[model samples]
Target: MRVFLLTALTMIAFAANSVLNRMALAGGGIDAASFGSIRLIAGAVMLGVLCALLRGGLTLGGRGRVAGVLALLVYIYGFSAAYTVLDAGLGALILFGVVQITMFAGSLVAREAVPPRRWIGAALAFAGLVWLLWPGAGPRISVVHGLLMAAAGVGWGVYSLAGRRSTDALRGTAANFILAAPLGVLIGLALPTGAAGTVIGAQGVALAILSGAVTSGLGYALWYNVLPRLASSVAAVAQLTVPVIAMAGGMIFLGESLSLQFVAASVLVLGGVAISVLPLQGLISRSSGS
Candidate 1:
């Protein structure tokens, strides 16, 4: 129950990230790259401070550290770049779909047993996404934006897989963010300078900080903490909530409208994920074993 709650909270946090980013960017308070850079730096500092206070120090060595940093960079940059052209809800859908597919593929590569019901569930969720995002349905999606979000999804999938092997979730994430922050800044500087000067403001900075420190950094740490106890298939299925939750956040906070197609899609996606993740056989076995 605790794990489930944590997972739910994590998804909400992830959803909040999308809403906050959209709010910041759409409000003309920040450019996408600047937002990404600021977010990474803030999250790194916040997590670093927390680690110092809790652990008395922080350090990362060897291959795991290297991989973590690389994955973090990919996720941060790709995520920021995507928002430049993608609508909030559409971006979330694309990102989550790619993530689901990536993680599901990872499970296969790792030889995790995927049950039939879970496959069906994944299909249903995908069907929902297709319905929601099909051109002329909800929002006009840019191909470039879609591709960038897809890259972000793949990056996050790799990050999640990498984090699963870490012994200390907070320490590892802190290390990754600390290492990735400088690169993020460098990339921000290299991007076309027009958007940087025009878009960013105090409000954007605040939003970026909130996204980095609270939702992303802490949320990711919590997710890593829980990953070891979950199977790959379970993790893949669990991520299904991210898009739906983001959609709701978009509607509530951003005044995004929900159509009948969106509602039906949400049902299909959530239902599919529930079917995929629940351990029905365990319940059956326990009943029969008893």
Candidate 2:
């Protein structure tokens, strides 16, 4: 039950990040570069403080430190820029679809044992996502923006894999955010003006701070804490819920429309994720053995 709650909160946090990002970018609250920069810096500050007070300080060096930081940077930038053109839900769909693929492929490359059921579940979820995002399914998708989201997905997948090796989730997450904050500044500066707005507003800054300090920073740390407890496939499939949640958020918060297709696709996604992660077999086996 505790693990379930933690995982659920993590998913909500992840979905909220999308809503918040879109709210800032789409609402003209801030530019993509500025939002990303503030998010990274806010995340760094929040996590840094937490680490100092709670974890006894942060560790800047570890086995997967470089990969984690690099992956995080890519994800932060790609995600921000993609939202410049992509709707919140659309961008999330693209991001998680690629994430599903990247993580599944990574599992195979690493020779991780993935059950057949997990594969079927992942496939089902991906199919639902495809149907939801199919041409004319919802909103029109931009090829360039879709590609950018895909890259973000890959970055996220790699970051997840890297974080799995962490000895301390808080320390590792704090270090990643801290190290990436300055680099994020450089990346923000390097972004093409056309890709994002140049204007900075108070509402935009507030949104960025909320996104960075709360959803992203705390949420990521919580996820890292939960990751080691879940199988790789289970973890990946579980994230299928983020897009659905984000879509709902878009409808309620962004005034996007809801459709029957969304209802159908959401069912498929939820069912798939449940099948992938539930421990029915374990419980049944234990009962039988007893």
Candidate 3:
């Protein structure tokens, strides 16, 4: 029950990121680079303080630490930059689609034995994504933005896989944010979105804090805590829900329109994810044995 609740909350937080990013970006309150920078810095501050309070200090060094930090930066800046031109929900779908592919590919590269059910689920989810994102099928997706989101997806996928090996979720998460914050700032200045003349409003700053501190910082901590308990394939499929949740949030909060095609595709994608993650094989085996 605790794990379920935590995972659910984390999923909501993940979805909220897309909506919040769209809110700030579409409203012209914050530039993508600045938003990503503030998000990392704010998350770093929040997580650093929490780690200090809870764990006494931060462990800034670990195996694969550099890769983790780089992955974090890629996700932050790529996600932010992609949103400048991509619709919130579409960007999310693209992001997660690539995340699924990346993680699955990583599993293969690492010679992890992937089960057949996982392949089916991943395929279904990918097919649903393709259906939704198909040219002239649903929303008009931007190819450049799609590729950018795909990069973010790869980053997130690697980050998630890395989390499974973490000994301390809070400490590790804090370290990633702390290390990435400075790099995010530097990358922001060079990125087109981060240059001078970008507007930043109080409302945007507040939103960024919420995104960084509550949703991202704490959210990632929760996820890292839960990751070790789940199979890699299960975790990958579980995140397929984010695009649907993000789209719903966009409609409710951002006043985006919903289409029937989206609903159908969502159902297909979710069904695939469910099939992949559920313990159907176990149930079938038990029933047969009984």
Candidate 4:
């Protein structure tokens, strides 16, 4: 029950990131680079404090530590930058689609045995994503931002896999944020400002803080804690819920329009995820044995 609750909360937090990033960037409350930078720094600060409070000291070194930090930077910056043009719901779908593909590929490379039903579920979920993102006339997607979001998805996929091996999820997450935060700042410094009238105000800072501290910082740590117990495919498929959650949040908070297509796709995606992660195989085996 605890694991189930944790997993549910983690998905919600992940979905919330889309809405928050869209809110900050689309509204011109903050520039993409600065928002990414602030998000990383804020997460680092929050997690650093959390580590101290929980463990009495901070431990910053671990296997795959460097890769984790680099991947995290890729996810943070690419996500923020992509949202400059991508809609919140659409971006979440792209990001999680790439993430599912990347992790599926990684599982193959590692030679982890995957059940056939899981593959079928993944295919269904991917098909649903395609249906959602299919370019109609007057499509709002920007080629540049779409590619950027794809890159972010790959980064997040790698990060999620690396996190599965962490000995201490909270400490490892904090260390990665600490290392990545400065790199985010450097990348921000190098980029030329593109959007006019972008400024960070009190509301932006507050939203960023909530995103970084509660949703991202603690949220990522909690996800890491759950990752070790989940199959790689199950983890990937479960994230299909994120886009649906983001879609609803966008409609409610960002005043985005909802379509019948989105509703139908939501059913497919969530149903596929349920098929992948539930205990159908176990039930079948038990019944046959009896």
Candidate 5:
């Protein structure tokens, strides 16, 4: 029950990241790149302080640290860039869908055996995602934006896998953010002419800070703490809630409407993921054996 609650809270925080970004960007307060850079810097600072207070200091002198930093960079920039054009709900769907697929792929690559039922469930979830996200017959997504989001998904998957080996979640996340912060800032500076001017004023800065320090930095640490206690399938299935939660956040906070199609798609996707992840047979067998 505690793990379930923590998972729910983590999903809420993850969903809020989209809501906050939409508010900042659509309001003309911040550009995607600038917002991304600010998020990394602020998150780095916040996590650094927390690590210092909690652990007496911070260190990144391990193999996992290097992987975490690289993955963090990919996720931060790719996420920021993808949102420049994608709607909040659509972006969340793509991001989380890709995350599931990437992590599934990672599991295979690592030789972690996946059961047959899990694969079927993943397929159902993917099919539902395609139904939900596929554009109408009128137009298609830009290749560039699609690639960016895909990269972002891969980055986040790598980050999750890297954190799985960590004994200290807070310290590991802090180190990754701190190492990646300068790179994010440098990338922001290197953007084309007039790009930097898009991010403006205090409101934008505040949103970015909240996204970084509260939702992303702290939320990631929480997730890391939870991962070891969860099965790979459970982790994948749990993330299915993020897009639905993000859609709800969009409707409630951003005045976005809940379309019937989207709602239906959500049901199918979430149900399929749940089916794929739950250990129904294991529970039943244990009960019967007992």
Candidate 6:
């Protein structure tokens, strides 16, 4: 029950990050580059404080440290920029779909023997994503934004893979945020004038801080704490809820409309994820044993 609550909370946090990003960007409260920069810095600060209080010191040196930072930067910037054109729910769907496919492909490349059920599930999910992104007569989704979200998803998948062996998730994550914050600032500064914006109001800054400190920083720490307690399949399946939650939040908060197509695609994608990651292994074992 405790693990379930923690996992649910983590999923909410992930979903909330999408809503908050959309609120900030779509509302014209902040520009993409500045929002990304603030988010990284705020995340670093929050995580650094958390690590110091819990572990006395932050660990900055680790394998894949550079790769993790780079991937994180890519995810952060791409995610922020994508929201400028993509709706929150749509963006979340794309992001998670790509992430699921990327991680599954990575496992195969590493010679992990994937179950046939998982393969079928992944294919279904991929088809759903393709259907959603297909050029159609429905409300148009920007190809540029879709591509950016895909990039963000790939970056996040790589970052997750890099951090798979972490001994201390808090400290390692803090170090990555700290290292990336400055680089993010540089990226923000380098953005074109139209992209970065000239003025940042209090509301925008507040949203960024909340997204960084609460959703990104503390939320991830909670997720790491819960990860060891969850089965790998359970972990993957649990994330399928994020897009649903984001969709609901988008409709309520962002006034985003849900098209029939979006709904259908979501059902396909999430249902596919459920099929892929649900524990068929137990059934397989029982049948074989019998």
Top lDDT prediction, candidate number: 6
C-alpha positional error of residue 73 in candidate 1 after TM-score superposition, expressed in Å: 2.0
TM match of model 4 to true structure? 0.84
Clashes of 4: 0
**What ranking emerges by TM-score with the best candidate at the front?**
6, 3, 5, 4, 2, 1
Candidate 6 lDDT trough over 10 residues, lowest sum: 192-201
Model 4 C-alpha RMSD vs. true structure (Å) is 3.2
Model 1 misses residue 135 by how many Å?
Answer: 3.8
Q: In candidate 6, which residue ranges exceed 4 Å CA deviation?
A: 137-139, 193-196, 281-290
Candidate 5 lDDT over residue span 194-256, tens digit each = 445755669989999999999988887678779789887677667877888888888887787
TM-score of each predicted structure versus truth: 0.82, 0.84, 0.87, 0.84, 0.85, 0.93
Where in model 2 is the C-alpha error above 4 Å? Answer: 1-9, 129-139, 195-197, 222-241, 268-270, 283-290
Model 3, position 47, has a per-residue lDDT of: 95
TM-score of 1: 0.82
Task: Judging by lDDT, tell me the better candidate of 1 and 2.
Answer: 2
| lDDT of every model, 2 decimals | 0.78, 0.82, 0.82, 0.81, 0.79, 0.88
Q: Where does model 3 exceed 4 Å of error?
A: 1-7, 132-134, 194-196, 224-240, 286-290
lDDT by residue (40-114, candidate 2, tens digit) is: 999999999988888888889998999999999999989998887776777777777666667777888899998
Question: What's the lDDT for residue 6 in model 4?
Answer: 87
1-290: candidate 3 lDDT, tens digit per residue: 88777788899999999999989888889898889999999999989998888789999998778888999999998998888877677778778766766777788889998889868877887787777667777556676776788789899999878876778878888999999999889988887854436677997888888899989988877787797887765675568678888988888988888777767776766776666666778879999999
Q: What lDDT, from 0 to 1, does candidate 6 have?
A: 0.88
Judging by TM-score against the true structure, name the best candidate.
6
TM-score, candidate 6, is 0.93
